[model samples]
Target: MTAKAHADAILNLLRTAPGTPLTVLDGSVPNGTVAPYVLVYFADEDPELPDSRPLDGQSQRYVVRAYVHSVAGNGAMARAVGDRVRSALLDAVPTVAGRVCWPIRREEGRPPERDESTGTVVMDRVDVYRLESVPA
Candidate 1:
């Protein structure tokens, strides 16, 4: 997908960070991998409404899942790839961290949903596109 491609490119760029001693790999994140994702919930964390508590009294942080698998060795290529991918993902989608209520999507599973009464997050969708696959 175009979004994945773009994401991949962005991730690859992060490999250039100074003093990094690992190889940057592109198009290497596993495609058939999947796993559980949970929300790091917070309370009354809305920046605009710091004094207001969510109707449910809980705020959601990081409503996305991270599924990274690789066939490469544990050190160089694999580690670098992981580092860059993690950094890139966080940078490109800052809300993916333990502080934002990103939406969740799935191909064969139930996604998160917002509670109507509480206005708490019910569902979150995190969209990422890998832009390149050229291994470093």
Candidate 2:
């Protein structure tokens, strides 16, 4: 299984998970996308065991961000979405072709912050996860 394949599996899981927010995007956010959505993308990846001759598989890192438009400048909605995302993905094993993915583990998380780039009070909470996989 390749790193990109692992990422795609994770995105698919999030998109279908019942606990996740309604809007789940794979890397790119369409213009005029409503608030209260999730953006998922690959971050970093490395071989699971560099010394292994057969190349076991990959350890991939992915970033999942929950965004919400908060006119109050508060992150309550964003945080809620983040919580749902965490619950939906943490320790969950996703099905990937030619790969056996282990339970997803959270590497780190960041508190929600307001995005000032667009002059809109958009609150986003970021979290990183690690997924290790081996050939099936």
Candidate 3:
């Protein structure tokens, strides 16, 4: 599947999740928008090959950023939002458009930090998955 499809799948998962505060979107949130919210963006895609043979599948990577604003700017709320995002997506093998995206993994994550310009706390998480499109 394409990066946009991967992002959309993750966004849909988060949107339907119970008690999740993330406002998952296909793109970045509007300027001056307040938190708590999340934006799902396509990062990159690489070919997955076990041998030197022609490519059979793809490894897609997506970045999910959770944001929250606080007067203290302590990032506590932002971290909480990040935790929710992680809970919803980490280790999930969600399906998109009837295709299975398996072996989804949390590649990396960043701790919440204060954005000087927006004065909001933000946390970034990266998720990678192997989408097997062809026989092995």
Candidate with maximal lDDT: 2
Error of 2 at 129 (Å): 0.9
Note the residue pairs that clash in candidate 2: none
lDDT of 1 by residue, 1-136 (tens): 3234333334344444345433433434244322212111111111324543356656422122333332232234334444443454443532212232222222122222233333322223222322111111
Order the candidates by lDDT, highest first.
Answer: 2, 3, 1
Positional deviation of residue 17's Cα in model 1 after best superposition, in angstroms: 13
Q: What local distance difference test score does each model get?
A: 0.31, 0.66, 0.53
Q: Is candidate 2 or candidate 3 better by TM-score?
A: 2
In candidate 3, what are the lDDT values of residues 13-96, reduced to their tens digit? 678766934566555567766666666655553544455235443443333332212122346766666667667766676765
Candidate 2 segments exceeding 4 Å error: 19-21, 48-73
List of clashing residue pairs for candidate 3: none
11-41 per-residue lDDT for model 2 (tens digits): 7767776843457787777987767888876
- Order of all candidates by TM-score, from best down to worst? 2, 3, 1
Q: Candidates 1 and 3: which is better by TM-score?
A: 3
What TM-score should be assigned to candidate 1? 0.26
Candidate 1: residue 96 Cα off by (Å): 11
| Candidate 2 lDDT for residue 31 | 86
Please give each candidate's TM-score.
Answer: 0.26, 0.76, 0.66
Candidate 3 stretches greater than 4 Å from native: 51-73, 119-136
